[model samples]
Target: MADYLSVSALTQYLKRKFDVDPYLGKVFLTGEISNFRLRPNAHQYFSLKDDNAKINAIMFKSSFQKLKFQPETGMKVLVTGRVSLYERTGEYQIYVDRMEPDGVGQLFEAYEQLKRKLADEGLFSRPKRPLPRFPKRIAVVTSPSGAVIRDIITTVRRRFPIAQIVLFPALVQGQEAAQDITRQIKRANQIGSFDTLIIGRGGGSIEDLWPFNEESVARAIAESQLPVISSVGHETDTTIADLVADVRAATPTAAAELAVPVLSDVLAEILKEQNRLYLATSNLVKNRQNQLNRIRQSYVFQQPQRLYEAYLQRLDTASRHLNQVMTTGVTDLEQRLQLVRQRLLAESPTRLTHDDQARVSRDTDFLNRAIQQSLQTKRQRMERAVQSLDQLSPLKIMGRGFTYTTADDEVMTSIKQLHPGTKIDLHFADGLATATVETVKPHEEE
Candidate 1:
């Protein structure tokens, strides 16, 4: 065989061929993506596949950053790049410069992706806040020197001059404008004075109005505490900020109109309501006056005191009836008393006779003597019981030169209860004595 080339040499030779070939330098391809993963702030590495073949692909961070849509697995996409050999790995792959969805533009794909993401996160599902019927203080967030600001100011001034308009000028376009809009929104909340917020800009192309579609601006509008009115572009244009805002108006002037009530219309409504209230009050007063007059024509009102006359008459009649009933009750009670007196006089009091009184005296004397005898006998019996108790008491035995012995606080009555080295107590009439026995002597019965 001829001299064999090393792997590195072969790879370098192939790389030179690819670089010189104009067709390999710029190749456009369409395929399904596979093994696609986004590295944090780094380049992307993935594979592009079709039904019949597959190829390795890479995109540097610079090119990836310029992509409008994120590349995902299984996505059909078109890539514009060059095929080159990686000499160290000896692998030929495509280095992509730009990418887009296969059939649609990257912008449209990005729009769909962001819309789906926000929808899944419930950003668009939140309840829209109602606008104030009459805003007192309104804040406008837009460019200071634009037709949007001018239109808003003019519309609001013509509609409701009483409302105070505060302006928070912000950049409404370009790459850095999303962060600016977000900062202004937070600043508006920090100030905490405006009743409503209007964030808007004049109409422009999709690329020009892209700041309002940015995720940062959308998040800012969603998180705003104030009721946000979005008027980002023309009637035909819609942005993510509009989807997330509390209210969306077609134009800047419409946003302003929605923020505050029309002064003339409000004044006319006030006048109408005032007239309605006056007529209601007048009718009420007239009705009450007529009611009073009708009441005055009534019989009770005409007679003045007739309402109470019947009650007074009934009270007088009741008083007379009460007096007659009391007189009859008194006469009946007097007759009953006289009849009882006669009956009492006609009969003798057998319970109070002389013989009964004498018998009671004799019984009382007998009871007194019996009570005295019983008390004396009970006294003698109690004294005998007390003497018996005193004689039988253990303390009385102790007084007779007898000693009581105990061990461990238990009374010991037998010699067998003695234990050597045990503590013992000897109780006497005077006090007690504690003793320890060195030897036990159990007594034997003779």
Candidate 2:
């Protein structure tokens, strides 16, 4: 069996050999391309080689189309592929899953590294802002020319023409692209008044879209006061701008769609609201009309006199209650008055006077003796009080040889108060005399 191995068996054994080898199964390769050519609608056939070695490499059409750049012969490349043997040719080649120029590959690695860093920083975890329902203006940051601006304009106008498009042209690619995009973002913020911002370009290579992945652009997007929508490259592509922006649209036109609603949809909503209002108003009016009809057809309105009849019935019941209350009260009062009359007759003043006449005579004699005794005691007390008063009287003082003298309507108690020519009235207990003060003598201190 070892000496006579069939071609199929040999190829199959080699296929298994290449498949089973851990180093060759999947590989990371860096080399210069040789004999590389892009084939139309077919897989790419090329050779990857350095100065010392060479290996056949093939990228299927699906993988080739996904490359951001076209590969050329003698170009430095980085590739990821798996080693496999061609069944018919029995030749082992690398089936490349991904390939890129080494410089671009490094940039892509940087992109991924930065992406992970930002993710860890939670810059991508923030809640996305909501686009305004009816934005007054939408700011666009991109090159003024190209399909990006055109498609955005077309979509925005077609969907909601009322919202104005404010263009802040920025370099979307190049070394200064990140700075330009950052400047435009800040400029848009300075101008204000925009409810939404769309920053991006159309489909492009990784280098072309690199500005969107730059840290400056991502920081600007994260800091935007207005809701930012990122529309960079095609549907399959993503960038740091897309992660930080409030919304991500696959295309510029999609960004426009997100920025505003369809006019007809808004019209329909307004129409629905109008209809609801009309229905509510109609129902309210109809219910009120029904209530008014019921009121007009009520018994009170049908027979106008019945309204007063209810009041009359109530008045009659009240009148009967009042009569009953008054009659009961009068009867109670009469019974009470009869009891009072009997009590008054039993205690009549004239009968009492006759019954108590002899007792009154005896009480009167005793009362007269008591009155005489009380009068004698009171008279003696009064005479004592009168004698005390007489002792304090000025007439009593005059009897004791004390007199009151006056001059110029002033009492002169001291000789120094008298003036020689002053006329005064001398008052005594029994008499008054008009006299002139002839002289005044002051006694010596000794």
Candidate 3:
């Protein structure tokens, strides 16, 4: 046991050796990532392997957060980190601080990744603000000493002299450029009164124009309150700023032209419109005068009384026709009245009353005779019914010296109703007698 070293002790010795090794302190390695999976809020653990060898690699969340493009399994990457050993697992691994796609530059890869992400978020497809036809004042964001500002001012003054130009000076290159550009955009919007915003710089290489490609600059342009016209580089160059802006111009001069219209052309157009209006008004007045003169020379205007002649004749004829219609109507009404009077005389009240009285007298005499005959028939039928009912009456049978017996106050019609020792009542023609049954007598079979 004294000669044996525990596993923990051996692991600690190896870890110290790995940590202090000069070659392993800041190693630059290029390999394909394997078994890579994202771990939220924790360190990223994966394997990096080439065709010949493999090694375990881990990147802390802080370092992983700084990576612009997402890393996946089997992707080739270049990483800068140090080799270290884990005491518990007795395994050696690389701690990565920086990583990038193997072939492409880091900045370009980051740019493409951000662009895709924002496009997926619908930022690129968002409805862009429409540029105003005429801007009263414009704010330019760029390097104060650059040729871009000079070119914009000169072009604006040449095209639209009345329009005002204000410069919000900002760094347009290097790392701070993106932040400065975003700041200027916000400041311009905050101060207000600017109709348009122009952000640009002179033509340069991709690296020089990279600030405009930054995500902050792109987002600021997209979210700007004032319509932004981006003019970065020459006609062939396009940046993220250009895509997000309301309008893209090939050059700063073009941006200025887009901001304002040409004064001379506008003035000429106004003058032309004025001439057209004057001509239209003069033609309208002359035509109206010619129409009035033609109307004055008409025969109706010269003979004013003739205008109403047809109407007057129509009225006179209408009056005569009305008088004839009224006279004929009166005559017809008088004939109707005479006819109605004759009909009334034929149906006078006295004659109608006499006829009605004669009919009533005849009806009364006939009704009296019919009533007497009905009474005689009813009396004869009632006397015959009374005689038939008297012959079938039980009282008539009893009066013929017949008798009936009852038990329990009910009349007995059969001999079986009589039983020995049962009390009974005998009904005679004019009396009822109660008696006890001594014997029951029934009819004997012959």
Candidate 4:
């Protein structure tokens, strides 16, 4: 019993020793993970082991959040961390800082991880953009030595010789391939010459085709402003890059077909349109000719003089009818005038001038005698009537000792209408006497 130490003191000493040790400070270890469990809080706790040796490991929540894919038991992983002692548990373990998939280099896992993520984000939705129908310049991202580029070139040339093909000359496989493809895509965008991008490679195994499945490449395709067509691996082969791409073709030649339009087909379409135009023009001309022919065959158009001839004949007929009516009217008027003259002669007293004048003179002498006798008789009767009227005249009566007494130019016949002092005039045959009314008399007659 040289020196007995408490477990706490012992563990503390060991923890300090491990923490300060140079060999255990930082390490890179390759092992298969065991007893791995993801905590509900996202921390990872596992054991890294070989056939004979094992050590406890922990991935904190923050460091675990950085991993693109989930880890499982028995997964081969390369971990970099420092060996440290847990003071509380008095256990030795490795605190993992960084991790990568061992056999697959973590790229595949990252590819799958990104594919699931983008798929969840709807990047692989069917609403992908359509490729250009007539691309003028097509950019290709593939090895310049491969049959993929050759096939694309030949297909594009055969389909549309007018389309210019530019090669981006990128690596198609291995570690550097993904970065190369991404760089070239960016470079092509920077150059800004190509109208469309065709990213493709010859068909290969999954390992040989791993680069195209990279998340970086997928993201590059997704972020590209220009349209991209992805043709990688075999027809059945699918990749994360293909999912994020604008269009996915089965083959390199298919991608070329998608990029450009067929010149032959276009020419055929134009020729068809031209033929239609020619037919339309021909029909128009035919219709016009038919119209002209119909016009020429018309009666008025064929014999223009017939119109004037018919009008002149109508005018002549009208003139003859008018002349007949005038002649008949003149004859009837002449007969009427003669009959009227004869009737006037038969009924006229002035037709026998001597007899009429003698009769007129006798009648005039008789009228003058009758008029004189009438005048003489009228004068005698008038004298007698005047004598009788004179006998009845008021002046005559007044001459026979009659006078009229008037007050205010009224006869004072009534005593009731007279006043005793009223001024009056007395009318006599010789003169009128002005006097005051002194008296009035009333008489009662039976």
- Model 2 gets an lDDT of 0.87
Per-residue accuracy of model 1 over 149-249 as CA lDDT, tens digit each: 89988998999999988999999988889999999999999899889999999886455687998898899888888999999888767788999999999
Estimated TM-score for each candidate = 0.47, 0.49, 0.57, 0.42
Cα lDDT tens digits for candidate 3, 12-73: 98999999999999999998776565678889988777657789899999999999999865
Clash numbers, per candidate: 0, 0, 0, 0
RMSD of 2: 19.7
| Candidate 3 off by > 4 Å | 1-132, 145-151, 173-175, 189-193, 201-254, 328-381, 399-401, 407-410, 419-441, 444-446
For candidate 1, list the clashing residue pairs, or say none.
Answer: none
The worst-scoring run of ten residues by lDDT in candidate 3 lies at 102-111
The residue ranges of model 1 lying beyond 4 angstroms of the native Cα positions read 1-102, 303-446
Best-to-worst order by lDDT is 3, 1, 2, 4
Q: What do the candidate models score in CA lDDT, each in turn?
A: 0.88, 0.87, 0.89, 0.85
Model 4 ranges with Cα > 4 A deviation: 1-111, 288-446
The 10-residue segment of model 2 with minimum total lDDT is 102-111
**RMSD to truth, every model:** 18.3, 19.7, 14.9, 21.9
Best by TM-score: 3
Ranking 1 against 3 by lDDT, winner: 3
Cα error of candidate 4 at position 70, Å: 25
